[model samples]
Target: MTATQSGPRISTEDFRFAFRSHPAGVAIVTADAGDGPVAMTVSSVASVSIDPPTLMFSASAGSSSTPTIRSAETLVVHLLAADHVELAKLGARRGAERFGDDVHWGRLPTGEPFYPDANWLRGRVIRRLDVEGATIIVVEAVEARPRDDGMSVDPTPLAYHNRHWHVLTDRSMLPPAVAPFYAVYGRE
Candidate 1:
């Protein structure tokens, strides 16, 4: 039965509409296949733990980068800054060589693609769950590098909601426990 007439049906459009209202931090998840690098823009990144340094993010199963991501030995998740709109757009795009000359990127020792200008966590996939239409991947952080350049390290995150990009800049009010660290280390 259709959602409107049904017992337990959920409309995809309605679910998407609800999600569109929730703002999420933007990030780029990158990995390298034997041929080259592949990536996708995702806002689903979430920290799962500190003990194991784990994080999770969802990637579309239909994405061109999906095969590479699934086959890759490691993944690099770059937390974007407010100024990374262009990179966000580029990563969001489908098909074509994303690591073209225009993109400033390098390779990690493990051969995963890396973006130096953002706070990034590189890790090995520990688990994968087939959920809805996406692949929910859990990665254990093997290494993490914060943006070292003074620029773009303001902690103002690049966010997405309702099909639009936004810069979350208001950081005046922070939790007491987090404020001290926020002031000292700044945002990532």
Candidate 2:
């Protein structure tokens, strides 16, 4: 048992602060609602099982898009490249502006529109888990492919740390190939 057992419970602010400091790759979790393209910025997207080709992402309980994403049968999780940091902010913003004309989107074979350039993994909804304050979307990968011109994951990732976007480059840390687990996006 650690200090957590005798808890003065971790404050949400403190938890968020700690979580923010730990770098995470950003992804755009998207789907098409009946009306139009819908997506949200999610740092929690990840692969949970390889056997079934599964992935998961959590959405805030209060997000309006949560309902839409949950109701949809499938979704596309787009891995953000180093150059897509600005687009992450756009998806995270709260308002109709997120749906404005500035965004470029297209449909998948399922006719579900997604942000075309964000680099994606299309998945079918497997299950939904209602966590404390958010709903976790566990989806099984139906198709995993990169956008036509998307770079293979070897390019440096754009990460979020301390609530700011960062590029992973120390030149010194640049190896011929990144470690296997760190390979994200379309890098296989």
For model 2, residues 84-126, the per-residue Cα lDDT tens digits are: 8878988888884565678777777788777776678888898
lDDT of 1 at 12: 83
Error of 2 at 88 (Å): 0.7
Worst 10 residues of 1 by lDDT: 146-155
Best by TM-score: 1
Residue 59 error, candidate 1, Å = 1.1
lDDT scores of the candidates, listed in order: 0.85, 0.81
lDDT of 1 at 158: 83
